[model samples]
Target: MPNYAESHRDLDSYISARVPVIGMRTIEQQRALRLVREVATHPRRSSMPFWIYTRATGLRDLRTNAPLQEDRSLTGAMEYAASQFTARPNATLVLVDPDDLEGDTPLTRHIAEVARLAGNNSGSIILLTDTPVWSGLQRLGMSLQLDLPDADEMYGVLAGFLTDHQGIIPIAWSEDDARRAAETLLGVTEAEAVNLMATVAAKGSVDKDDVPALAQSKDRIFSDLTGLVKVQLKDADYTVGGLSNLRDWLRRKNQLMQADLRHTEIRPPRGVLLVGVPGCGKSLSAKAIAAEWKLPLYRLDMGAIHGKYLGESEGRFREALETADRVAPCVLWIDEIEKGLAGRDDGTGVPQRIIGQFLFWLQESRSRAFVVATANDVRSLPPELLRKGRFDELFFVDLPDAQDRKEIIQLYYRRYVKAEPDPDQLARLVDLSEGFAGSDIEGALHDVGAEVYLGGGAEALRPSFVMDTFANTIPLSRNNPEQIEEIRAWGRERAVAAGRTAGATTQGAPGPARRIVFMED
Candidate 1:
């Protein structure tokens, strides 16, 4: 992926500059072909000889999209493209998803030879693919990694299609809501976005009610991501048990995420580090944020990515990160992150190398991937990972207080038991669940749900059943009190509180330990 700070150019610029071996990466092959065609048909380049090649289609004339019907092998395509540059000046060739382009093979060498021939003349040879080309070949010219439309561009697409259908049907989305809808569809191509618009208007109306459904609809076209597991969010996941501070912060940052910031210098929040007690909704909060924002949720299992072969882990990690970039404007959940990046230095130095790589990616990545990393052992994390600007914020999620515990009870009770607990029942259950983590409360409710499911149904479920389950359950906080307090003490001094305790007047955010400022002399 190109750096977010870099500006993209019109394809015509390459032809005007007479760039040879122009390596372009895009999944939308036809779209890219059309762009190349447009550049070729421009008045200045109108008289230039143009050719295109694909393994399936063989060689074709760019003018008519007509096949030349000769040697259909890659050798024939390069032979043809090479002859054009040598025979005439200012010619152009487009190779679309050709095989054997990545390494120093016969085809790669031929392309390099063709590139040199074209370079000597005022001609261009374009290598268009969704995959990377060989570095040696690419270095002969320039490269561009085409990305999907950002929010502003996507909004234009949505408005154009909907405008054409304005008088034909009901269209209820205003510009703001339409923009939000477009933000939800960020990972899709322009063609895919148009098709999705058709799906929305298929029923003869495009209403604001369909906005949330955009994320749901986008699930149909998610890219085949490797190593990163897609996490499906339930409706209940939209409402987490506690962490009011974290929730409020997310709500505020969401505006920036959905805004058309193409014209602005500020970027969206990179993400937050949630360090807190186990089962205090740290992991669940990541899901809740994605659900609330109506974005796709993906979990990067750091533990599963480790490989025994040399540099195998780094390669897999790179692939996964690339996949994340491909599907941006989404949530990346790294649960129990310390388990992977932090461990006893086994003298291999692999852990340090991986940590360095991860930190660098986190700092420099321009994709709008909101990373929600949760860690129970905050102390185990390397100090550099917690630097002031590494994450947007580091939130400390302490064990839920009585009020938070009550909300947790009610939320899970309503979700799992299929009914709301009455006020008195809620009060009794809240008292029973004191010192319980959100997961502990949820687990007890799950037990009730399972028992009710086995015995009969919701009719068989009772408040006593929930109370008894909570009573018998021993939360991790109680099972290991000393460790919990140690974590709490560390958080109290260093991190911001995710949930305010009883009688606390104001929630806190992490304050910088030091400050720096520069001014013109």
Candidate 2:
């Protein structure tokens, strides 16, 4: 499929060559009509006789809306088209949305017959449809697919649509606002765009604040699409205690991610990979990114992609990725991606093939989909996936340090204990949770909250009870010291630390620095 400009040129070339049948396939019927009119009214092709037919409009002059016939049925329209081809040379007939042309049926064969007649007279048959033409009819001429408007072309389409409502609606949009709205409304059709604007205008005023409504409207069209789960974001879900380094990086990238980069050679920032110890904030970071950036979040469920039949697994994975692309300017969270792309195959090679397909899409896709993939086990990832440039950066999420634990404790303390944490008590709690991950701190706080709930209210909450909750629980680092140490060692060596640099480096620093220099001139 070509862009609008390319499609126009190809349509013009095909019509000039007297391609007896031109199947213009598109979901946008109005846009297709406008394109046909533009081509028909061209100076070089201005003299050619052009007519259009719809069930409601019957047959009419395409350039002017003059009725050519009183017949209102498709049968009647095709009957009239057949006679016109033989009677008039260089006559073009546009059949708008004719049904039953998907296979070589009676109607398709009839269309093929009319196409042959048109060919003899240097005329053409234009089928304006969103369906596939029968092979018999398609053989008579060529077909071109008109994809949805790109951002550049969409600006014009949106501006034109909005111009019609100027006097009636109080539109508070400038050129920049319109461009922003147009970019957000990229995936929907021109008709849908107009309808959405109309929907917004129906609310009594059209202002800059209503621009986001356009995106909301566009999203409604694809609300029920398959292969993705729409994650409902909660403010609490993004409490995100630490990872200042990751947070700062994401904030900077968000600025570039949402900007207009079509004219510039610089590509939008792709995404990041967070791999580290379990129960750290890697998973929550996905939610935080979406909340921070104000974009929709979709969790790609790899567990759902596996199928009982051959090829079904690959098909599902592809569908999931395609769905993500369709809903652009969104965050795609792949939690524990190692589990999904591990290089293990049962007698069949479905898993291997899926990995290849995934990498190709991730590398080539220019869509505004920011992928946030997390993994607990860095060792399980395929080598190709970890190569440079796969993601914008690779971040390692270590366990919450003393500073991070203090913040996490204070955050959940406010939520659960209904009070600000005492700074001195917080210091003690932080020390107690030295090896605790963000999740471990959250879990401990959650227990404190639960205990307060069961024991009447926050008034009855004992500081010792909260202290005991932190003291009694054995964190993951304590349960499997070897495994946690191994993960921390790998992260320290290979990945960018997600927490602040000081918290990241001060942990387990090599003891006793030595000086080797003596008297080198």
Candidate 3:
């Protein structure tokens, strides 16, 4: 149940201002009813009489907790309440689980009419719902969404639980540990917070060791959501190479990313957009970030979220975002974002509406699910998405430079060949792999290792064979020269270089006279 004290002031202000029809959208029906009773009886609000109507209980006096048995049916209760409004002009009537009365049926019409009459007097009709599915009544009422507890409120909840169960349960938690636990449990409801803490206390102690368990609990809370895959990081030792600028930026945000440091004034990093050549570690960086931060990674598959049924796509998308919020201080990896947003301008208008929803979440979401969106084609992305505030920064990951290629070659050699190539061999391999992507270099190394197996001897693998293999493979830069040029042109002007050094690093760099046309294919 929600805390009545937390929301009573807002409810009182709404009634005092004479907002005739109020929609209290919350799952905590009992808590909302309690708040309505408290607000109605307060002296500041003129101590208006309040009535609560439910299908089971019918119409009842909120102050005395007495039922009007004669007015038990829905029609009789509403009609009786409407009659009382003429005599007790400033009264309030609340109805719970009113989802059925949201249509244009006679009952709904009567409810709307009752709302208008209640407004003429100083009375109001408050509708309470767990799932606010009624669009019709929403227009007639001012909907007030009671959100889950914020950090401070969650802290109070945790502290109160600890105090209540201290001697009885033999619980163990310091002030610091309690604060940290509250931060981890930010998105759950007040009831859920108490239940989760109670579960932890049932073990006879609540310590810092239980924080990971809390995160896993949050994961279970969101297990029903589709298109969001929880990435298991155990034994995953991958890292993105040669993006010094990106690496440094992430390192600087290391402290702020710690959710336990809620007392700090610095705002945590939202995330970055990685737009550049395919197979250039754009997607890899998203995974590597979670690994580097030791945070959970969730891949939001935008393609998988699109449903054929009407409004299904939007519902799934909203659920996915909500799940991300519930499991915060985590990384949200969206790979190949351009592919999802490519046909957004088409006829159905579904894609455009989805884009609008996505934009709203991106700008307004207060959750700590850092968004790391990777895009292969920038020109297809909406211009609004490319604006400055959409992401913390837009990084352009061009092909590995000469030095990056060298480091990558050495890395692959050590991984597959199990030996570092001699300096002369390393230099030759780097020079031969110019314009090769990280994937291309890694692929060539895999091929070189395969030859050793087929030759039936580890000694069959040589540095020359590795160099020859890479030299023969034509890179994406050469095969798609026109597209690569266009991508480079867009990145150079609008995005920060991911590599440490800037300027032309690839051969046959486009000149000022070269005309680069945007092409999807």
Candidate that would win on lDDT:
2
- For candidate 3, the C-alpha RMSD (Å) to the true structure equals 7.2
Question: In candidate 1, how many Å is residue 213 off?
Answer: 2.8
Candidate number achieving the greatest TM-score relative to the actual structure: 2
Predicted candidate 3 versus true structure: per-residue lDDT over 1-521, tens digit per residue: 34445566677778878787888877666656666777777776556788888888888987787987666787887888788876778888888886465456676778888888888888888888776535665677676866667778788988898888878875556787777677778777777777887788778876667765675565555565567998776542366668888889878775566546565654557788999888888888888888777667899989888999989988888888888887887889988888776686578777787778778888877667889999988988888888887788899998889888888787777776666778987887787777788998888887876787687655666555766777676778777878987887888888999987654657743322232222222
- In model 3, the worst 10-residue window by lDDT is 512-521
All candidates' lDDT scores?
0.80, 0.83, 0.77
Candidate 1 overall Cα lDDT vs. reference?
0.80
The TM-score values for the models, in the order shown, are: 0.82, 0.89, 0.74
Off by over 4 Å in 1: 1-20, 54-59, 66-87, 111-124, 134-143, 150-153, 344-346, 415-429, 445-471, 502-521
Give the candidates in order of lDDT, highest first.
2, 1, 3
Please list all clashing residue pairs in model 2, or write none if there are none: none
Write model 1 residue lDDT over 325-403, tens digit each, in one string. 6677789999998988876476877788888888888888767789999999987899999998789999999878778
Clashing pairs in 3: none
Error of 2 at 65 (Å): 3.7
- The residue-by-residue lDDT of candidate 2 on 1-521, one tens digit each, is 48799899999999989999999999889888999999999998877999899988888999889997777788888888888899999999999998898997898898889889999999999999998888888988999999988888889977886798888878888887888777777777877877787788888778987765565466677777566888988869876888889988998898787677778886767789999889988988999888877778889999898888989999999999888877777889999999988866556888788889888987888777899999998898888888887889999998877777788889889888778887877887887777788888889899999998899988887778777777776777766777877888898888899997422432422233222222212
Error of 2 at 271 (Å): 1.4
Candidate 1 residue-wise lDDT at 217: 82
